[model samples]
Target: MSGRKLRQLKEAMATILDDLNRGDLFSIVVFSEKVEVWDPALGEAEMQDNLGRLRDWTESTTDAERSGTPAPSVITAITLENTNKAKRFVQNLTTYSATNIHGALMKALQILEVGRSASPEQTNHAEERPEPMIIFLTDGQANVGVSDTFRIVSSVTAANAGNSSIFSLALGNGADFPFLKKLSLRNSGFARKIYEASDTALQLTDFYRQVASPLLANVTFRYQPDQVEPQSVTRLAFRRFFSGSELVVAGRLHGNNVTGEVQAHSSSGSARYPFDPVILPTTPTANTMERLWAYLTIQQLLEDDDASTSPGKQRALELALTYSFVTPLTSLVVVRPDNETRPVEPEEASFAAADRSRAPSHVSPVSLSSFPVQGAAKTSHNAYSRILPGGYQDMRPISSSGAYYADLILPAYPVSTSASLDDILWLSPNDTTVSLPTGVNGTSEVLNLATADETNAAYAACVTPGGQPGHCRHLKYCVLLTFLNNQTEFLPFFCRIDSFVGVCCQDDS
Candidate 1:
């Protein structure tokens, strides 16, 4: 972390300590290559006293670090007292060698479990269970012990044992968004990304406040048959729900049914909050609810696919293609006119006449036509654009050749006028590659691009400073390309397509 980021984290931690209620139980676990828990054996009263001491210590250390002194080791622990220990721990945290995410998470889980078992009296009371949860924060990929994402997630899940929820905060652009998101989703919590900025402290505080307010826990949504029975129902269970958040569930009707009853099951499982379902008049309007349901279902299936189930993977692909989503199983193929090729001028084509001196001798030029072509299929962009409000008409128009162009919007930088098609690549769910179309044409013969790994390797070799692969490992499937007026001016730039409903943007270089 940068000095600015460290300061922001300290500020956020102070705010969190201030916001905590007196009866609330909390713990802090910090890890680099090893884990450290501050005040591990301190009781409630002793912990509070330790917190005061920690506050003074942290202030002194902060002053030293700000004066150009090297940062000290991490200080972390858990507590139930209203003390500044958590704040001081955050302030004293320093960037270390490798990120031991698995160790940190495992240690947290152990603490929660120990707390639960050690206090059976408190565990018996629903309100006194302490709402065991792990708020995991990380800024980089796991490079220490048990670095494999799936293994780490599985270990966390097993450690949770359905008693605790894991709320993950991915700090900065380097954090693995997908890994954190999936981890939280599977464990009955949610993941959020915290971008590095001046207001990062404020963002962290707000997120803490939101997660701190849990209106309901272990919630389940069920549909009861009143007039008719539905053909199927999607799984509707969440580990925790915030005070102001909304929960939506969607399903299909078996017949021409109009009325049904939906019930919500919460902590008091027997008590059901029932409501008469309302069916809005179906017109030519976009089916936002249905699409949302599909997206959620696909997300669940993808998470389940981590278990190596082939059926779940197949179902996710089916939904993605049905909705025109670019998933691991499908690629977005852009078709343009085959006659749009530019001719090489005789003078410009001559090796001697060309500006060879400006080009690197060690690097070889790659042609867009080098990619293979596949067949074309007709599809709409509605599935991809439904996340945005308004309606289908608000979407950008499809080109006459049936090509869909999505504008890449970035808040920090100006949008590119045109992006090289060579820059467009497909990223699979597992961060593996399926295929990348080098270029596309309106003709029946579509370009069949190289596999994701091959394309990434080639692109990495040419773009990376060290000519090493995996340098662009963070590159996702969602790519924003520059829109050029003439296709012949550069290689065809394709949009980063995904199985989910969201906009794509350029990678943070």
Candidate 2:
């Protein structure tokens, strides 16, 4: 990757970190001749003592300020907010001699595997399988090493299933879109092409934050009657961001009692489920109208029009105008048609042209007084047992610290394995005053607090935190609430490891 493109990736990643919930994890793997692991970013730290525990290590160590900074580029711009956490978790990314994409995909899966196995606390905390993801951004095709493109593609597709969604972004004109699309589509993901380098950063950023943030995971639609299919009602697409994202499902309704159920599982074992089934009322109001015009507007933008193409484009425009004019609700129930083979006009065909053009922004007014609303009743009486673990447990093999960079091994393929940085530092977060790892300081290099750290905190805070015997977030899982020096809690935030800041800041991406 060029310096310009690398910087662009960093900037785009920063945009996503700030918007993510604390529990989500995002990994960015940059594959050239080597591989790198960029970990999750940190939220704001809480206030603590001025002379932090790590101050002792700095006493013997010469201040970079006093010793003169290494170089102008030594201090990477800490511009992104939650990057502090990510920098600490990921360290010492490896460098290689060849750009092997197949190798990179395998390495990404390994990192996730290691993360999953690293902590019993994490495993215990998670309600379901971690929704892992791999956003592979490459500018060229597989040119070096094992170059069997078909086998490479098939292997990657099979590897990515269930565990992660692989989104491949092809940068510059050199990228092969057909190949990239095949790889992404095969693995329940998609491929996007950047027209040029200028468009790379923003698109990459959008793909990370907007598309990745709202996870519409476990999306399934069920409908009966061959005449009324839900898939035909509205076209549906799913995008996965960090961890928790809303599933947007909008489509034309073809019958009365139209029901739509959407459910998402949180880090807590609890499930956030929403079910909608409403009768198709005949009386239409301003609030009852659907915004089908927006869909039509998208269709218009997708068309190619010229002087000779005037008539065809005009017909599309006219239909859009009619749809906007009538402001049709999604409901389009038809028991039986007068003619079976007649091409059905869009629900918008019932409107006038002038009214369509004069239409106001679609806004609905819902009156709660007339509609019945239901609330979720509590099934259990006890809140404490429902949320927090009832016991206190301490971590074993207390101290573990070292810095060694080596290749990450993928269990399935030895040839595809590559090196990555894994730094496991330890820290203790007690009530009132929290302490970082002995030598760790700042957000860039974090002291890897083990699963023990998370487990200990759960015991200290929930099971034995003074008078109130209650859970932290209240959902049946051990919650690791890392209180920064400032007394603020930092939830898990996700970011690319290549952009990760730390002591051994190798060019991972």
lDDT of 2: 0.36
Error of 1 at 382 (Å): 25
Segments of candidate 1 deviating more than 4 angstroms:
40-81, 117-129, 225-232, 255-270, 284-286, 307-309, 326-388, 391-509
User: Which 10 consecutive residues of model 1 have the lowest summed lDDT?
Assistant: 369-378
Candidate 1, residue 271: Cα displacement in angstroms equals 2.5
Clashes of each: 16, 28
Task: Estimate the overall C-alpha local distance difference test score of candidate 1.
Answer: 0.46
Name the lDDT value of residue 482 in candidate 2. 25
The lDDT per prediction is: 0.46, 0.36
Instruction: Encode model 2's per-residue lDDT on 376-413: one tens digit a residue.
Output: 11111111111111111111111122111112221221
Predicted candidate 2, C-alpha RMSD: 25.3
TM-score of each predicted structure versus truth: 0.56, 0.41
